[model samples]
Target: MELWPASLAEITPDLYATEEVESEDKEVVAKFFALGSSLTWYVVEAQKLEFGDVLFFGYVHTGDWNSEWGYFTLKELEQQRYLGGIPRIERDLHFEKKRFGELDLEQ
Candidate 1:
């Protein structure tokens, strides 16, 4: 994984215990974004990660989850091109060629 190039700090238990805790962290949450966009990109707050916590993130061209262009495992992030999610896009041309390849060679 790229490690997001960000860090998380420890929050005080007392501050997080109050009913207003969520409100207090509103600004902090707003500033936390996994990916940077051309319009709004900045290094903001840090996120506290715990053991066994699943760090699930998807790489998207337009930030559209439904329009998934690819998928990626955390392992792939170490490579430069694999920084973003892997593309699962279906190309009609490629699919057709693949299907053709599956046919009997004699034909």
Candidate 2:
């Protein structure tokens, strides 16, 4: 699936847009995950740079003990690959937008 699709752009707030909002109140606009792994990214906002690159801000879940909110770029996600060079990360097509507090973060 296409990450940073136009439809997503329409809904995602610009970078820093939610900085003033409480984490739980922020709206997660999209979800991405690594195939065959538990890693996940819950995008809350994004910004399209002048050079045509997109930067995303979200909560990243790397493991049971390691998860945090941070900024990531589309290029970074695309560059991640499995041993066979297959793209490892993919957008969760079935994901629906929701408040961050509604997420089952324990997963």
Name the best candidate (by lDDT).
2
Best by TM-score: 2
Each candidate structure's TM-score, on Cα atoms with residue i matched to residue i, is 0.21, 0.93
Q: Write model 2 residue lDDT over 1-107, tens digit each, in one string.
A: 57779999999999999999999999999999999989999999999986778999999999777799999999999999988888999998999999999999777
User: Which segments of candidate 1 are over 4 A away from where they belong?
Assistant: 1-7, 12-16, 21-30, 34-51, 54-107
TM-score of 2: 0.93
Window of ten residues with lowest summed lDDT in model 2: 47-56
For candidate 2, the lDDT comes to 0.92
- The local distance difference test score of model 1 is 0.25
Worst 10 residues of 1 by lDDT: 91-100
The predictions' CA RMSDs to the true structure, in order, are 18.4, 1.2
